[model samples]
Target chain A: SQTIHQWPATLVQPVGSPLSLECTVEGTSNPNLYWYRQAAGRGLQLLFYSVGIGQISSEVPQNLSASRPQDRQFILSSKKLLLSDSGFYLCAWSVWEHFGDTEAFFGQGTRLTVV
Target chain B: SQQGEEDPQALSIQEGENATMNCSYKTSINNLQWYRQNSGRGLVHLILIRSNEREKHSGRLRVTLDTSKKSSSLLITASRAADTASYFCATEGNAGGTSYGKLTFGQGTILTVHP
Candidate 1:
């Protein structure tokens, strides 16, 4: 059984503070990873996705960036956070190709509040 | 730019009634997927329909896709209070490669199932 983990579960930071959110997957190897953000009562916005280690594609232009340092480790970072960055962040992973039973699985998520 | 847009920004319904959500996309896609998100929680994958397919069912959920109309619909039969959540549609385009994992999301529909 594959499981995804993200942390810290919640964070409160002042404007311009640096931010780092981590996501790791267990029970799978070399899976595609994705980062998404959701505002209250809104739909998800795909921020970034990775096909392989060190390979990332960004969807939106923002102060945030993502990196996949290892096969199952992904990181979301912001050198300087802004008020608009406050939202619920999610991490997801999916198996490559072989779509038989492969579906994206999400982590518990991180609630970031930028004050 | 988002790929799909769900209609009826918000809906409130009594339990036991059926709930239907519609999604329209801007460009041609190879497949479409639906997801559900509880309040402040990560999204959960619901269903996926290929462009060649018209309808699919899982439990009390039924999904229909019409490539000719560039739209899709999700139906939750006999809804319950626990069905209250936001629903989003995602699109997988036909570019870059057949199995490319890039997915674009849309604004979601918020469904409130009152008990």
Candidate 2:
């Protein structure tokens, strides 16, 4: 069975403060990892995705960045957070296959509120 | 820019009723998937229908896809109060490009089932 773990289910940070959210998955190898953010009443926006270690592709240019330093470990970070950076962050993984039709598994989200 | 859109931004229903949500996308997709998310939580993959398949079912979930219309629908039969959540539709591209493995999501339909 595969499980994804995301830390600090809730966070409150001041504007301009550094931010880091960690996500890791177990029981899967070489899976495609993704980071997404959801607004209060809107759909999700893809932030970053990694096909493998050291390989990252960003979909939106925003205040946040993502890094996959090791397989199954993804980190979302921001050097200086802005008030608009607050949202629900999610981590997801899918099989690294070529068909592009596989389903994704998501982790518990992190709720960040910038105050 | 490839994001999909779900209609009836919010839906309220009673327990033991049926709920239906619709989603439309802009580009060609390899598959369309339905996901459920409780408030401020990670999304759970509910069901998926491929571009070649017209319909799919899992438990209480029924998904229908129309590639000609580039649209999909999710139906929850005999809904329970616990089924209240935001339902989102995501599409994966069949045409590979820089954004090959990423899943594009639509603004979700918020479903609330009351007991």
- Best-fitting candidate, measured by TM-score? 2
Q: Per-residue alpha-carbon lDDT of model 2 for A13-53, expressed as tens digits?
A: 99999999999999999989999888888888888999999
Q: Write the per-residue lDDT of candidate 1 for residues B1-115, one digit (tens) a residue.
A: 6767889888999999999999999887778889898877777999988878899999999999998899999999999999999898888776645444666778899999999
Candidate 2 chain A weakest ten by summed lDDT: A94-103
Displacement of residue A30 (Cα, Å) in model 2 is 1.0
Tens digit of per-residue lDDT, candidate 2, span B1-115? 4479998799999999999999999888888888999887889988878889998989988899999999999999999999999999999876755444578889999999999
Give the RMSD in angstroms, all C-alphas superposed, for model 2: 1.5
State, as a TM-score between 0 and 1, how close model 1 is to the true structure.
0.93
DockQ of each: 0.49, 0.67
Candidate 2's TM-score: 0.95
